[model samples]
Target: MDNVQKSMNLMGLAQRSGNLISGEAIVLNAVRSRQAKIVILASDASENTKKQFLNKCEHYSIPVRVDFDRNEISNAIGKIRTVAAITDGGFARSLQKLQ
Candidate 1:
């Protein structure tokens, strides 16, 4: 499969395994607490939202991927969110590998 499809499949796995978290506030909290190993933000997000997430992830030393759109992400994780984070390092690394 293509990298994007693989990444989305992995996200589904992460969600099923309880290693992924979603929503803006919850994801920001996870980043602040260092629980978020990697963050995935929708590429189509508003510039303000994008800036906020990018800045926070940078400050926290967490990796961020801004490739997929909100629908793609929500479909992968089965949640209607524009932002999500992988809490498990293994899952995070797996996602990073797709980049």
Candidate 2:
């Protein structure tokens, strides 16, 4: 599989391993509390959502990735979500490397 596919698969693993947090409210809380090692924002997210997350991530000095669209991300996690946070540093770095 290509790197993108691998990344999506890895996201599934992360979720199953309880290392990923999804949904806007939960992710926002995770980012605010510095519990998130990295944040992934769906590329097709609304402009306001993109701006809010990008700015919040920038403020917190947390890494952010804008790669997969909402469908791809939701498919990987088995939920209809546009945002998610990786709490494990190792998984965060792995996702970053895949990009």
Candidate 3:
């Protein structure tokens, strides 16, 4: 599969298993709690949201990706307004290939 497809697939798996954090508050919580293995921010995410997530990720030494737009990210993660933080390692690895 292509990078986008791969990301979507991994995201689907995450969603099915209840491993997803789809909202801003939950994402921020995950980041602050340091439970995130990797942080994926939508390219079109607002500057403030992006900055917050990136800053947290950097503070925690977590890796980050901005490869896809909001639609692509939301589609992949199976949400409409997802804007920040954290995913399972497999998804993280798949996204890493795109980077």
Candidate 4:
């Protein structure tokens, strides 16, 4: 699969394994808690949200991807939110190239 398709599939796998956390705050919290393996932010996310998330990710050395738009990301993860974090092991490597 392509990058976008792989991301969507990985998101589905995360959801099935209950390793997905949606929304900025929850995802940020997961990152702060050192539970997040990778963070995915919508391309259309608000500037402040994006900036803050990026800053935190940088501070914590977490990998992040900004490939999909809000609708696409939300659709892929089955949420309306603009951000989501995967907390499962090995998931980060799957998204590394996108970071």
Question: In model 2, how large is the Cα lDDT of residue 92?
Answer: 96
Put down candidate 4 lDDT per residue, 1-99, tens digits, no spaces: 677787788887777789888987799999898899888898899899999999999999888888888988777778798999989867767667544
TM-score of each: 0.98, 0.98, 0.83, 0.90
Task: Give the per-residue lDDT of model 3 (tens digit) for 1-99.
Answer: 676777667766776777667677887788788766677778888899889888988898888877778888777766786464546766566656766
Q: Which ten residues in a row have the lowest lDDT in candidate 3?
A: 82-91
Residues 6-68 of candidate 1: C-alpha lDDT, one tens digit per residue: 999999999999999999999999999999999999999989999999999999999999999
User: Which residue pairs come into collision in candidate 4?
Assistant: none
In model 3, the Cα lDDT at residue 86 comes to 45
Residue 68 CA displacement from its true place in model 1, Å: 0.5
If candidate 4 were superposed on the true structure by all CA atoms, what would the RMSD be?
Answer: 1.5
Model 2 spans > 4 angstroms off: none
